[model samples]
Target: MDTIKKLLAAGKFDVVLNQLQERMLSDESEERKDALYYSAVALRYLGRLEEAHQRLDALLDCWSDFGRGHQELGHTMYALGREETALQAYYQALKLNPALYASWDATARIEAKLGNLQQAELNAEQAQFLQKQPKQVVGALNLFHEGKLFKAERICRAYLQRNPHHVEAMRTLALIGAKLDVLNDAEFLLESVLVLAPDYNRARYDYIKVLQRRQKFPQALAQAKLLRSDEPYNPLYKALHANLCSALDNHDEALSLYDELLSDKVGDVAGVYVAKGHLLKTLGDTKGAVACYQQAYQLQPLFGDAFWSLANLKTYRFDESEYQRMQAAVSANETRVEDKIHLNFALGKALEQQEAYDESFSYYRRGNVLKRETSQYKSEVLSQRVDAQVEYFDRDTVARWTHTSAQHRHLTPIFIVGLPRSGSTLVEQILAAHSQVDSTLELPNIPAIAHELNGRQVDRKKPLYPYILDELSAQQVEQLAQRYVDETRVYRSEAPFFTDKMPNNFRHIGLIKRLFPEAKIIDARRDPMDCCWSAYKQLFAEGQEFSYGFDTLADYYRDYLRMMKHWNQVFPGQIYTVFHERLVNDPELQITNLLNHLELEVEQQCFSPHQSDRSVKTASSEQVRQPINTKGIGQWRKFEAHLAPLKKALGDVLSEWAY
Candidate 1:
């Protein structure tokens, strides 16, 4: 490393570049990125612009968030006299890392040349901000924004080692950690930063984001409240405060906050309308939601999310003009990739409602392709996790884990678990409609526990979770159980039992069973093709990555069946499986059977689950608000010709669950 550094320092670019190129082949992501970055820099200096561009492009292809690579690519493009393309690359680099002074200066120059003086002025000011920070800190900020989390982490840690108590460095590292989904690290770092510099509003705002990402809603709310108190008129803080309130189910308060923000004349009023529309939709206020969505559309027609929100209502019908606008927005070159995706899905739904199945399927397929290109989901990880659960939780292992005398005997929790878009939400609504049960939004406490059990070990090869289950003490198991009940209390009511309808809880049934041995666990099942088809078409708010691809969805469904079957075997009669089709066909009989499984009296309310006016927060929210019916039962048949890949992937499940 010293030799190559000295060679570069002495202007021996070719010798050092060759050495760095060989080192770039190492297995370590961080090391390879470092070598590749240095090599690209050397290539530019050696006037090998083409080679530098190729190397930088390859680096960014692997690590799309690498802001330095984008900046270098911009430089190479500029040197090659492709100034227009270079301007875009610079903008991309700055989007991830705002502190890229060189990129900013280059962008400003290009924009000035293009006669975009206003944008050039803005770029010049951003460059001045970067000039105030240390060069190393600016580099770290750029890497952090570019999405090179590992590289950013390294730079921040190294800088912190030298500066020891730099708050900005700590905050930057925390932001990177949050981006990397290491919420615990981000939380601790942000907490430390606040202790050092309590007046740092930006860090405090980031702290709120980290808390929210960790599902610490109460903590996030408190942080947001603090920010709002500090800057009572700040629209961003006000909006965040309203969002946190909504998350906590304080809908009335959230609505008031939104109203207050909407009245702010200087604010981006259209965004609040969209936010209010979502909140209204969640509260089952369809008319008000539609009005708010329309208001947003009127304010900003190009905002695809507004139209998507209307279509996501599953009941919204688009007029011809709305349809044409969506089509134009989708075809427009200036429309963002993200907006185009939403527009495509909305258009697909609109066409599907009109019975244009072929065109609808094409739109849906296009949207998925666009989304899949950016998705980082890998099915093998999910497959391996399932395999580990099956291997680790045999009958003997289950019995051993539950052999301890201490147990939380409370049956106040009813978990409705299944694939997203299965009948889980419908089941939850039915149970919640019962006089003895209350409904909570899909609580993250259960999965949060599993995440906690998967400790913070840095090694990637070691299994940290189910394997560690064998080592848990009886007291620890009891505490984990009690902790879930305690933490989830915020989402409960005075009703004896509350339903947590987290569909993904199907993944962690073993931990759940060991914790609350008597808790009612309903395995909501639907016809495989219908369920997978619904999931494929739905654009979930978050955390259903498996449904984005047909192959992944099929493999996930098969593994889910395997896990549920294993659980049923180990704990016979413990899980109640409800077929969605059967439930839809014979509501009374199915409701009676479901109520009997829970040891509750059969109620007419359960038969009319959709009439309860409860806030359903799933893709089936709208459907579940209507009477039990078979409208969605075999809807997959309409797209049968386009479902060959799905049918092939589903294999046995499709055949077995055929109508």
Candidate 2:
């Protein structure tokens, strides 16, 4: 055994194997058992998994009291992807020594691979609890991988306290702080890691991420530059750099980088295609975006982000066949949690589009549940970690500004706000169809920016949003607002007016109105059940909280309505209401009214979105590809039978929509 260890430590794997062969006739039971286990592990690591399995079986048939040996065997089995055997090995190890954290961690990995996240988390917790010290970092990392953030934080912090210079511990702490929304803490921890180890490119890259999450754009850019200085050719750095540039509205530079990345030699760069698709979509080249999606799909079909994005570009109205295709795509593909949530929602939407209400509800329900959990992870986890008392804007500010702007006190820009699926895309498509108007699809990303501005919302009752309008000087507001307009200039170069249709802008109307007094705000409404349920069914890429399931979706719908009602009451005629059904039914009347409100000329194509050829990167893609049909007019009726729970929950609140 001692000789084998020396060979293994000296990197003499072949020598170790030869020694094992010689030990086939060892006189003692311990020597024989040792020889069998070592050979099995060596064989497994050497990729001779079948032989390793046979050897392991022979050993287990004889002596099996070695807990650590069983754990090592399980690790080898897991490496071979024989997960059931790995679980059995872990079970045997635990049967011998229940306190073994390695055995628990192995079990956790198997459970996670099977997608039993709850059980995986529980086992990870058990493993972590068994070894709650700095030496237990490995087990703690397993807990973190399983998304047990709180436990991971405790383990990491323990190490950080004793060994402040530990790079891995600091990196893990930074990540945990980021997830918990403690941006400052995360930033400090990561920066300290770099101070101790300036050559740590991975930590530098992750620092950029922390800055990005905090919406510290300039800092993020600076850190990104520093990172590039160290590793100029790293695709990961370039990708991150491209993302920051895009966020900063430096699209020209972003596009150039993205174009260069189109031929990226990196085998794992999926976002190059996604980035290319975004650039094309923004350029009004839907066909180009389609090609990019196809490329992305080819690279990773199980990548649900690609599938959902592709479905968003579909010309089919999510008809039954198209829905089946999306299902096949999702089923055939593997994905991250966010992508899975999106795919499920898209599948539900396709079912809804086909008038399969019950089936649609099932898909919507599943997607909504995932979305809620995701949101909880965000607001409860990420947001909680950031600096407290950071503020963001909401609709009340828009109302105040609209009222003032009407009085010529300010010139507010026009806002197109609603739930994502609630005619926001249609509104933009219709408005962009006009001669004087340009539409920038769901953008300006208010949530991330808001979180950054406020530092943290220490007291939710006194949110930073309400105070921003009363503070920021004219110059600051104008600069911030104008910078936004100039950045989006690519989308509206020729038009006199542009629409920002980011749905969550409903939360920041006050800031928008104050920034651009001339801004006309459009609050598009469909039936509550329709809008909420519709959103639940469709899969959005990012920054949507209500698209996952029924109860959570319903609550989110209520919050949206309540906020909108406050704005309407605060500044009545300033916010125009466009019923989605009415707009589809009387396109001309609604177009004329909507444009007249924006002080733009109504174009003939405004009513014919199908002719625009602009990419529809929302779930409404298929509907917009056809002439305004009454298919969606009675859409809520078919779902009414299946949405009894939703309807009962909504009560007469949906009566205003005249269900």
lDDT of 1: 0.83
lDDT of each: 0.83, 0.68
Q: Model 1 Cα displacement at 554 (Å)?
A: 0.6
Give the lDDT of residue 172 in candidate 1.
89
Write one digit per residue (lDDT tens) for candidate 1, span 1-659: 66766887888998878788767999987778878887888898899888888888668756655666788889999999999999978887776667778999999899999998987997888778678777777788876665557787888899999997888889888888777666778899999999999988889999998887766788899989889889998888999899899888899999999999888744668889998999898889999999999898788766778889999999889999999989988875445566777888899999999999999999998888877866778877777777777887878877666545543464468889989888888888888889989788888888877866877652345558788887888788888888887777777777888888888898788888888777889999988989999988887777787887899999999989988888888788989999999898998888899999899988887888878876766767788888888898789999999999999998998666643
> How far is 180's C-alpha from truth in model 1 (Å)?
2.9
Tens-digit per-residue lDDT, 278-319, candidate 2: 666655566877777667766765456655565565452444
The residue ranges of model 1 lying beyond 4 angstroms of the native Cα positions read 1-129, 402-411, 457-462
Most lDDT-accurate candidate = 1
Instruction: Report the error of model 2 at residue 390, Å.
Output: 19
Window of ten residues with lowest summed lDDT in model 1: 402-411
